[model samples]
Target chain A: MSVSALSRPSFSRRALLILLSVLLIALVVGMEQLAPLFRALFPDQDPAMYERESFLNLTLAHLALVLVSSLISVSVGVAAGLFVTRPAGREFEPLVSTLAAIGQTFPPAAVLAIVVPVAGFGFIPTLVALVLYGLLPVVQNTVAGLGTVPSQTLEAARGNGMSAWQILWRIELPLAMRVIIAGVRVSVIINIGTATIGSTVGAKTLGTPIIAGLVGNNLPYVIQGAILVGLLAIVTDLAFERLERRFSFGESGAMA
Target chain B: MSASHNPTRDTASARLVANRVLVTLLCAGLLAAWLLPFATMSPNRLASGQTVGLSEALSAWQAIALLALSAVLAVAALRRPLPRELAHGVVLLASLGLLLITLYSLGDYAQRTLVEKSPSARVSQGSAFWVMAFCCALAAIDAFQRASSGWLLRLGYMLIAGGSVAMLFASGHFDDLSIMREYANIRDNFSDQFITHLVLVGSALGPALLIGVPLGLLAHRHVRLQGTLFSVLNFFQTIPSIALFALLVAPLSALGNAFPLLGEWGIKGIGAAPAIIALVMYALLPVVRNTYAGLKGVPPATVEAARGMGMTARQVLWRVEIPLALPVMLSGLRIVTVQAIGLTVVAALIGAGGLGAFIFQGLGQYAIDLVLLGAIPTIVLAVIADFTLQMLVVLSKPAGTRR
Candidate 1:
């Protein structure tokens, strides 16, 4: 709460990361006013855009799709990983892994093809495909993270008379938390990229501009979409990195 | 370990239950195949039409043959203390045979029914047949995984299976299936798409390595630069392939215009230039990250020792560092290659002419088989690239590090 604390190295770094991201978003949303400059760059082509959706709206929609699907996938993936690692669920480990692998091998495009017919187009199919695509990394990392928790630590906890649930909640998961977060980080970043494909099925993401540009051969629309999505990804990634650093530093400090 | 795995304890009681379970699954799969539709007789590719069950689609003998194979697999499963290798072998044969038979019958059924219908009428393999084939393939892959075969052997099995299917094509068996019909329609364009897809992948990889390796070296040699470089590369990577393709269009077109020679070299806003450029951008993160990691993994003691031995820095890098780093770098390359193959499909959306052309065309027409024609090949390409590169990684690993 102190001004001195705010001046600390980590706090300043965190502030910088957030500030940069906000500025990037502001630039992207204001890109329409910069159309003249863009037109100057690509002088041979018409500067007009056919993209009906504004950059801001598409960016928000893309983020919403990513947020929803990522939440669902993380829960499902983490839960599945936790279950398989449990003594009672050990037998299903291979089954869980195999299913996740199968989910991944089927491409998002193919997933779209299959889902669109059954679920129809727009948000639902896109969400379904994103969830499927995102599930594998989260599950893989969760399982790997939990599995790699030093058995000696668990044994010590058990010796202290902690119940299995208490051991998992207070001990195992805390220690495995960083790795699990890394998994979620990878999954979310991947979803951010994959979610653009949603525009193909009319879910209205940043891909709207890209696809529209491709169709119209309007180069600037494509540039605007690409810049926004790219910046969003960078911001999200930087935010995750900052969080990871804080966790590692705080956890180590606590342990020491 | 040997003493604990007593012959009866390992096999007798649990094996009996497992065998019964396996047999039941096989029987159930067989029942589904027989009772459900094997092919659909559509008036056209877009129209949903009548479903033809296995018996109606295949000649009686062929239908009986499929039934017999599943039954035989069930009976084989019933054998106690079955050799693991034998179980895998039987599953492999049965599944491969099932796939071949289904493809043959698909063509045959189409020829029989569609010959009497309008020329535009299409006959495609239906849901039941796909389910049946998937069941068989899953069973086969499961058994293969359990069998613990070498990677080379597994790849060999795949080649043999694919070759047999190719032989069927040569023998004119698949000429009537709707997928084949589509292939025949676009046979000329198919090769061009295939070549473009390969070129896109190769072009992306070539520049990625050139740029990524040095960037990785720079990141490695300098600590402060690592995060900035990686975050930038990572940001580019996280942008969707479609978005990346879009992002490149304006700048590249501008660059091409500013320098007319660039335009002459075919560096316009859209097409191969943008697609390849986007792919290369995507390709950079993995290659750079891996190269850095690989170089970092070179033991500091080894470097120190090399320097102590009067070796120049360059000599140490080439002789000690690179040799040690080769395997990890190859593994990184493997990831990039697989990722690029999949991403290249998206590039096709930008008139770059890859498998995505068929996928988009199929999407526009709502033709599932046409989409599969594109989707399946892309998946195959990715899988093959993944597997082959994985093998190279394993082979390239230093002997001491071999697992």
Candidate 2:
């Protein structure tokens, strides 16, 4: 009975996840077909649909930016976190942690604005901003995750004649993988939201329509953009939830 | 023992033991100051500027003096025989000096180069100047962190640094700088928008706490309601702020149309109404989650003891549970407050007037200083909010719980 109770909910959640993903793609691809509906909703506006860029193309570009930036952030942030935790690099730990904490307090919009002057407005500048802003969560989590590894476990690994590298790879990393992935999840989610604002600076993302609509005072375009972006965020968040659950399950199964 | 006997070897080893963080930051600052443009001179606000190198920005002797001071600080950081406190003191003072000298030189250069040439001519901080400033701030912060564990002392040091800069500004030393010029142009609007930003944040926070805390208490009491409550709040949180604000426009406008009285009260498609509503929605999750977690985190034994002492559930909750949960709940408030402050800047995009108006306007006009005028204060406000709330969280800890 207990097994069935758990399994049934898992099945439904997977179904919901797939359902949302399908709905998101359908909305992106067929946004114009729903033009009449939008026109009805927003009766007076001409060009009720956002058509300067294809929603499909915009979605892809948005995802690509988030992926590239999150990739760079995770790699650099995780490495920095690891470096500062090791014995050779321990003295720098406080500085790195303090930086991570303080960096998060700077608003993403401000960071993007500052980057424009130095890097100018475009994909590269937006990517730079997203990576820098997304970094704090990953670094903080990496440090926190690695710190959770028990001293006894490290001692045992050392007693077995394992090299520091071997222990880190074998014992420490696996133990910390769940937390690190949680960080990545947060970074990716934030990057998705932030990437929308990138459209303000000239990077083609879903926010393009919203900014354009706001400027033009067209409600339909704003709605179209907002709906698609909202869908994407919800879909991504649900996917991460599944991923986190899988990792935790695997961790427990390994112990068993 | 043998190394101590050999003074030369001891000194060599001492040289190897450098304060890596300070040395690295100082060296980077030096290289950036030497290589990057120290300032820019623009003919007008709209036009891009000509880059001026450090030597051109300052007199020969002044440039050398600044470099000499930085080099001395780096050497002081490297020598192990120097006392740690002394090294930190030297680093703090020298970095502060570098910061002051850099700013003074920019103003001096601007006065000499632009004041007579064109009244509208602007002097902006160049890449090198920004990099140098950033490096100095970080190095000074590191020194402060190392020099004192006490918050009061660290705050005192910060005040000394910040006060000096404020004094310099007050003295009109930076009058020729572009950002200051922008401030002069929009002085009235800047203050008005600044107040609006604070008002927006406060309005949203007030409603969020009122709704969220009770919901949190309900969730804590009822095991079954917790999941649904959190999921709903989390769903709201997952939407991007821009998207959330935009999404509210249609429905809100419809409401305003359906009820003209609501429209009269400023409940419209785009403005503070939707902006505050969306902010409150975004804020609810943190407050609710934190409050629930705080309440649930109270020790079962303590709750039992309270009951055993003939205390009613209400008394136990009010007197014991609330006090114990205060710190964690305040931490949640900290996150909510800071997040709201940042989000308020984005609200300006929707016509919810705030510092973001300057930011967006600057972005529109390609005026970097105008952007700075907006972005800098938003960051400062967020940082100040974060620091103050962190102190609150620390202070709220019950006597035995203080760290």
Candidate 3:
């Protein structure tokens, strides 16, 4: 709120982190656009691309997989997180966190293979696995991020006669949004890569080109997918950092 | 502690209705999905008379034993008065066993298997084994846990509750490797394959961490280079190890072509060399990110105090910052290590070798037993690696920090 606070040394850190990020982003775009150059240099190589599917559809399908699965995961996971966090259900928090961790460590691709028979191939099966895979970070982060909200703030909200829902919506969630975002950042980035395996079961996404390239042994296609995902991850991370700084206490002990 | 665990003291019928029913339903849903082979796998596939070998049967038994052991410990954790020592011992043993198991499995699987199955088989099977192994592993870890120990012990209770779930699913297990082999159309050689799977996954992690840590440190220090380098590494990570390998294949093959020395070192386009490079490259982002985050997280005050007291920047950093930053750094390493173990399974896609070979091999031929040989151990390796690294992070945390 104060001008002096806004002008702290951290502003310089922010600028530096941003400037480098822009440079890297430019490098990634340059790489994508200059593929023809690489193709020429490596004369034996075929240019990387999809034959049947347009890149737009593939990108949309990829986004849908992430959005739908993450939405489902976050809805249930956050509900579970909020439920376990409350007085009536706080005791079950441990049970919930363990299940989440197990879900996380559970191999999504392997599960995808097994689930293919029951769920059938393509989007649904991959959706199921992605939902399961994405659940932990969201749920665990929700619980943790909320739990770390200052006790005084929560109590004050409760004392003001805020309904439990109101308290959650108005108080805890806003405070915890930074960590929740962090978890989302992690889940999103991981999903960016993990989604590539979806192609194995016939789920179309950017991963399809990469896997097709891998199977067909085409380097440029693989590079294209890798480069896209890498850029997506970097961009999301920087966005999250900016959001965290905007939303979070500027210095919450700076160490812990 | 036993006082807190009075499940018997609670209104028994109410507890059953409120908790047990939901868990049962959840388990049933999960099991119904997992047991398609029993419920819907083709009889024609079954009629081919695929048989389970005695070895595989024994291996499944071993898996059961480990699961049962975890169950017993869970029960004990809930009811009896466990001395602090045994609980602490469980944590230590679980931590150590996970590491040792992976290391041993890696060595075994790394050396080519007689069956021509590669290392991914081991990684996949390792993950499955640990799902049970570390569930029990974490379950029994009632000691030395702060925030999570309660959950760990509660997991023990959940595992105890799983008895009912395990009972419902018991028939599924009863069918044995022979039936699975017959239906899936594969050989029975169950136990050895599972064991081999375990070894491959367990061992791959050592190499991942071995290479990941120093590079992480380098990224942490070179802040100026962080942007390009981190993005490249992150790119490597995001591509998935399988695709990364495809990209690497031509380059590796080219190198192998140009330099005879590279060829002699098994550094060709396919197989282990490409696999390792891809895995290592995939490893860099997490390691580096964690290192940078950890190093950056050192308290400004602490550093300032150290420098104010007449220490060089280097000295102050080594003494004041690193020790404090360790917990977060190790946490990052923990994630990367477990991830590496899991990804190694997929590396089999590129002929990188691990437990995935068995899973893929089974998928290729529809062999359930071989799939189990791969899938189970990969899961086991996942559990073990996860818990072991988790324990390390916990141990490294400031005394009394919960979790």
RMSD of each: 4.7, 3.7, 9.8
Better of 1 and 3 by lDDT: 1
What is the per-residue lDDT of model 1 for residues A1-256, given as tens digits with 9 covering 90 to 100? 3445434645655776788788777876677778778777667667554347677777789999999999999999999899878754553566567766655655566666566654667899889888888888889878888887887887788779888889889987877777788888888887887778777777888887777777777777777777788778777876876666555524432110
Angstrom error of the Cα, residue B52, model 1: value is 3.0
Clashes of 1: 0
**Model 3 chain A weakest 10-residue run by lDDT:** A247-256
**Model 1 agreement with the true structure over B251-311: per-residue lDDT tens digits:** 7877897899999999987789999888898889889988999999999999999999999
Ranking by DockQ: 2, 1, 3
DockQ of each candidate, alpha-carbon based: 0.34, 0.49, 0.27
Residues B173-224, model 2: lDDT tens digits = 8887888988999999999999999999999999999999999899999866
Candidate 1's displacement at residue B104, Å, is: 3.6
Ranked candidates, highest TM-score first: 2, 1, 3
Candidate 2: TM-score of chain A is 0.93
How many clashes show up per model?
Answer: 0, 0, 48
Query: What digit string (tens of lDDT, one per residue) describes model 3 on residues B1-403?
Result: 1321343335544343333322332344224323322112112332332222212322354445434543433433332354545544544444334323322332233232313542122211222233333433443332324224443554454445445434533544322223333433433444544454455444555575676566666766775566556656655654545556666777787899899899998778767677667666766677667777887787788888999999997898678877887888787777766676677667676666567777666655655555555766677667766766776777777876754
- Please give the C-alpha DockQ score of model 3: 0.27
Give the Cα error of residue A154 in candidate 3, in Å.
Answer: 1.6
Candidates' C-alpha lDDT: 0.77, 0.86, 0.60
lDDT of 2 by residue, A221-251 (tens): 9998999999899888878877776766334
